[model samples]
Target: MRADARKNHDHLLAVAGTAIAEQGVDVSLRDVARRADVGLATLLRHFPTREALLDALLRTRFDELTARAGELETSSPSEDALVSWLRDCVACAHEYRGVTALMAAALEDAESALHASCVAMRAAGARLLTRAQAAGTARTDIDGTDLFALVAALAWLSDQTSLAPRADHLFDVVAGAILTSAGNSATGTTAPRPRP
Candidate 1:
């Protein structure tokens, strides 16, 4: 890319990140272009599609989660690291109102521009998950895919206005299910009890 083109790309990404953070991921592409003082054609040239734009915008956060998982492997206990990473994934998914949907779709579509990033993110979680399971702390039957689904579900549930306030509690419930230790088992005393 030319110097001017690279400048525009950087400007657009900066502006779009701010826009999405304030407005939402669904903010118009044209709005992003206008905000960046670039043309729609230019934005399209750089991002191609909404998902591509989102993928770029969220790339840093995704990479951070991946890196955190690796750090956690050495810094925290096996089960603690896995649950902590799952919480981080949920937080990332909820960064934008609609990010979880985009992530969920990207996970299944290899053609998606975000697919590679999504795969990397899951692989990081898988490493932590495998460590936990090997330690007999997490369920052995579940894999990274299941972890992704659980994160997605947590993200979605966190978005529901009616249930949003209790989402953290729900996350703890599910996390307990994922654990298989003496006290942390799904039916154990640490599990969240259902409301009458």
Candidate 2:
């Protein structure tokens, strides 16, 4: 793509991503185009279908998130890094209210881009888990699948009006199960739980 075209594409994706997060999957191409200050024809040229557009935006978000997790993977205190990544993941998940719904709808259709992105995300997440587990701070029983479920729940809670503000509480509850530091329990702060 030309430089201007690429800029337009990036701008459209950013606008659409935020719109979808705030307005749910029903947001119109017109709104995205308007936010990006681009014409409808340009938006259509970039994304032929709403589902296709959503899939692209979802992948883009996941890609950025994966990079962020990877960047922090080697940080000291593996447990902190993992928990931090989990918190960030929830933020990324909430960027769109019905993101999980969109993924579900698209995943049902085999050979879809959504399916491909899901696979990629799973692998990336697993790698992070492996690193944390290697550091002997994460529970052996808990795997990437478990983490995925946690993120799903967090995202769902984030989409809810009543649960949104307390979303961090939900994450704290889940993190309480994973972090470990019984020795520092004296401080009375929510210390990490035992890994074993």
Candidate 3:
């Protein structure tokens, strides 16, 4: 890409990021172009599609979260690494409204623009979960898919106006359920109660 085109692409992405943060993943392409002071054609030239645009915007974040998992894996205890990565993943998913659904869908759709990034992110968390489980800190029943679902669920909860306040507490509740007594003690979480 030429310098000027690259500049425009970066500007459009920056504007799109703010728009998506304020509005959501569903924010209109025209609105993003308008906000960026660019024509729709120019935006399309750079991104081609909304998914492409989002793929570009979110790929970096996904990579960072993946790298963070690797870092935590080496630096933190197994349980701590898993829990910390879960928290970070949830927070990242919550950053852009409506992204959780897209991520969930993308994870299953190999052709989706976001598929690779989402898979890598899930794998990163899965590695952390596996490490913790191997150490007998996390539950043996749940797999990486369950952890990914929990993240989507937590992000969805945060998206709800009515349930937003309870998201954090619920995150702990879910996290506790994923962790065993030893995991709970390490993370300062209590075991979840059995349902009646």
Top candidate (TM-score): 3
- Model 3: lDDT of residue 172: 84
Q: Which ten residues in a row have the lowest lDDT in candidate 1?
A: 187-196
- Lowest lDDT 10-residue stretch of candidate 3: 187-196
lDDT of 2 at 146: 78
* Candidate 1 to truth, TM: 0.82
TM-score of 3: 0.93
lDDT of 1 by residue, 1-196 (tens): 9998888878898998888766767999999999989789999999999878888778778889999999999998888888889999998887666787778788889998778888999999999999988887787778999999999999889878899999988898889888875427432426422222
lDDT of 2 by residue, 1-196 (tens): 9998888888888899888877988998899889888788989999988877987788877777777677777654566667777777788778787777666555456777787766556566677777766766565577777787788788899888887898877677677665545322212236555534
TM-score of each: 0.82, 0.82, 0.93
Ranking by lDDT: 3, 1, 2
**lDDT (Cα, 0-100) at 159 in candidate 2:** 85
Candidate 2 local accuracy as lDDT? 0.73
Q: Against the hidden true structure, what lDDT does model 3 obtain? A: 0.89
**lDDT, candidate 3, at 48:** 93
Q: Any runs in candidate 1 off by more than 4 Å, and if so which?
A: 1-8, 21-24, 37-42, 182-196
Q: Model 3 segments beyond 4 Å from truth?
A: 192-196
The per-residue C-alpha lDDT of model 3 at residue 75 equals 98
Backbone clash pairs in model 2 (N, Cα, C under 3 Å; residues 3+ apart or in different chains), count: 5
